[model samples]
Target: MSEGNKNTNTEPWGGFDDNLIQRGGSAVIDMENMDDTSGSSFEDVGEMHQRMKDEEEVTAEAAATEEEGGEDGEFLGMKGIKGQLGRQVADEVWRAGKRQASKAFNLYANIDILRPYFDVEPIQVRNRLIESLIPVRMINFPQKVAGELYGPMMLVFTLVAILLHGMKTSGTVIREGTLMGTAIGTCFGYWLGVSSFIYFLAYLCNAQITMLQMLSLLGYGLFSHCVVLFVTYSVHFHSLFYLLWLVFGGLSTLRMVAVLISRTVGQTPRLILCGTLAALHMLFLLYLHFAYHKIVEGILDTLEGPNVPPIQRVARDLPNAITVLNATGKALAAGADAILTQ
Candidate 1:
């Protein structure tokens, strides 16, 4: 056997490798490197195993060090610092936790005490107020234009509405002056149609709306019409005026849609409404045309009189003038097209 193997098989205490050791010197240690006062010894294998176990315990201690130990349980606190610094951090964490718990307990106690007297309905109202203030969606560029125009347009409408109210309340009509009423109604309708068309155009471009926005337009028109009718005796207080304006504007938009959706499979609800309104308006206008023919003829006779004001006569003749203009324009367009084709 070699010297190294001989050392492995024998002990300094006169035992073979298989012999059980006495507690005194069974632990074989490297005395030069070891603490000499403790009477400790180590066998080569035993020393290695003990060193491994010590190392494992130190690793475990380091892992556990992150959590601060308390009587109740382990708390997630500064376990990173060493010695006194770690203890200080642990103390601060414990204090903060206690403070937070006490505050929470107090809050709960107060809520419980007030629960019986609390009115939930008011809470709902407050919530609704907050929700209303929180903007649902932003208004785009076109909607901004609509908002800017809405104010002045509304003022005009309010004046008209006031005039209408006055006429309805007065319940008086001049003789052979019924045509004047028809003319006024028609003009009001035309103005309303222009305003509505512009408003709707803006809304369409923006592709957004709110109930408030709709109401703003309606209110303005109502107020404007009221002012116009109440301040002047101009037999123009016709509700149909505003109705036709809304109807015609809607029809114009519908016509535009029809052009775009010619090949599409379905009609929108707006298209249906527009079609219905246009049909009804046309029928109603036809009925009025026949009904007021005699009154209109009488008004035309007055227009022939030299004493009649040019403005009054112009107002009387305007409807027929518009019809002529429309026909003339269409004919001119057709003529131009024919000349081009040739």
Candidate 2:
């Protein structure tokens, strides 16, 4: 091999070594240049990391906001359901109350059929009461008027209540329920029996009257009895009580006669009917008076007994106490006069 050839081969290897050194040197110089810009590059990386964290926080807040909105919606939905239930209950209660009120009203008045009777004006009631008190037939009285049981029912109840109150005040030893029942039954029985009897008689005579009308007439006639009872119980005078009884009884008899005569055709029949009715009415009046007198006498006997009530005893002794005080005062005055004369 020539010397040049050997040199060439060696130079090829050396060039390869030089190429590696140049590559290493260039790598070192690039590293030095990278160090000069290291601070700026780090700052850029920190900015990117901060931006990523900010995005993550935003995402979490949005998710939390969505969850709160969903909870609020659920709460509103429950409130709406509760409000609907409350309204439904209120409607049911209002409807039930209306139904109960309707039933009670129907039971009492029967307003559909008895509207006219129930609709009586206040002035009409006053006039009717006044007319019932008078003995004569009223000129403007409604003839063949439809009968109403409400007025008679109220009057009977009122009379019974008054009697019960009076009995209680007199300290009667009767059971309240038994006395009330007996009184109501007796009153109704007597009224119905007498009215039925009169109705049968009128029907036989072919009178143009109804049982209801007859009952209404007789029922109104009981007003005198109520008045007599009140006056007799309130006034302590026996004579006044008897006088009023006679007057009211006579007036009631005359009124019945006047009304009954108009219903009959023949003179003799009318007179007979009136006489019978008057006799029956007078007997009833006598029975009432005797019963009332018996009650009063019984109460008086109770008051006069050894076990007199405290209220009665106080009333009875008040006048005696006053007389004693007056006597004491007079004796004191006489003593003072004697002292002055000395």
Candidate 3:
């Protein structure tokens, strides 16, 4: 019996000699330590080590998949891990949105223009754009955007106004290419006058002013001209339209003088000197009117239509208007007579 017990002690726990199994000289089994093949355990340690190694490999693969943000996280019940990763993705999306908003802001520069060109608010911009064409005290007004932006924009609008007026006067799509040339010439001529005035201000008054500010003011002054042009287009059929437009042009000229007086304040004989430059504005308007009318007449003559003198053309159309009025009156009178007979 003693010899049998000694043999049993030399072997593993095979239903006998239970001295706590003596795994690595430890009395207790650490199941957590089963992953380490260096340690020993009960129930076929070699086989358990092989199984643990396989389980560790599978755990490592699942961990790698989670780190890589693959589709395997849901299968492995690693939804909590994805929550941490979602923040990085959201940050990227937010940055992209900011880029798009910035681009959109640049494309629509006039969205905050607060008022239309012909608006009559109780108080205009503090720069006193309403009181004068361009207030010298623009340095006081706080703008959401740059002052430089408003100047070039005004010029662009002036160009558009010229194009519209030319199209209306020509009244033919066939002459669009020629009309475009005329429009460009008209704008160029107006700017040439403005440039000449700017040079005069420099020579006569020695006004310490920037050309950019003068350009900005001149462009703003052109807005009144644009409005007056629109009125002309609206009422051109009326004989007195030209006379009425000239009245508005005179008022626009005064506002331009105000713009110049504000700029050339320190110079002696300021009003007279400014007037010399300001007179150019009136001449510019007159030149535009005469040149525009002549161009329109020339275009009408060149066009493939009834070749007649402008006087003849109007004399011809005027009779038709009178004839239509007479016909309509006769038709109404006949209808009334028929009703009376009934």
lDDT of each: 0.38, 0.55, 0.48
The alpha-carbon lDDT assigned to residue 275 of candidate 1 equals 49
- Pairs in clash, predicted candidate 3: none
What would the per-residue lDDT of candidate 2 be over residues 200-278, giving only the tens digit for each residue? 8877776556787777667766767777766766665778877877788677667766666666777676666778777
Per-residue CA lDDT of model 1 for 178-257, tens digit only, reads 63464466435644553455346435544243433433333223332332233333333345444543454344333323
| Candidate 3 per-residue lDDT over residues 67-101, each given as its tens digit | 67654334223432232233234435555776898
CA lDDT for candidate 3:
0.48
Cand. 1 Cα-lDDT: 0.38
Worst 10 residues of 1 by lDDT: 14-23
Stretches > 4 Å off in candidate 3: 1-129, 133-152, 171-177, 196-200, 237-247, 265-272, 294-342
Provide TM-scores for the models. 0.21, 0.50, 0.40
What's each prediction's clash count?
31, 0, 0
Ranked by TM-score, the better of candidates 1 and 2 is 2
Poorest lDDT segment (10 consecutive residues) of candidate 2: 13-22
Better of 2 and 3 by lDDT: 2
Candidate 2 vs. truth: CA RMSD?
Answer: 32.6
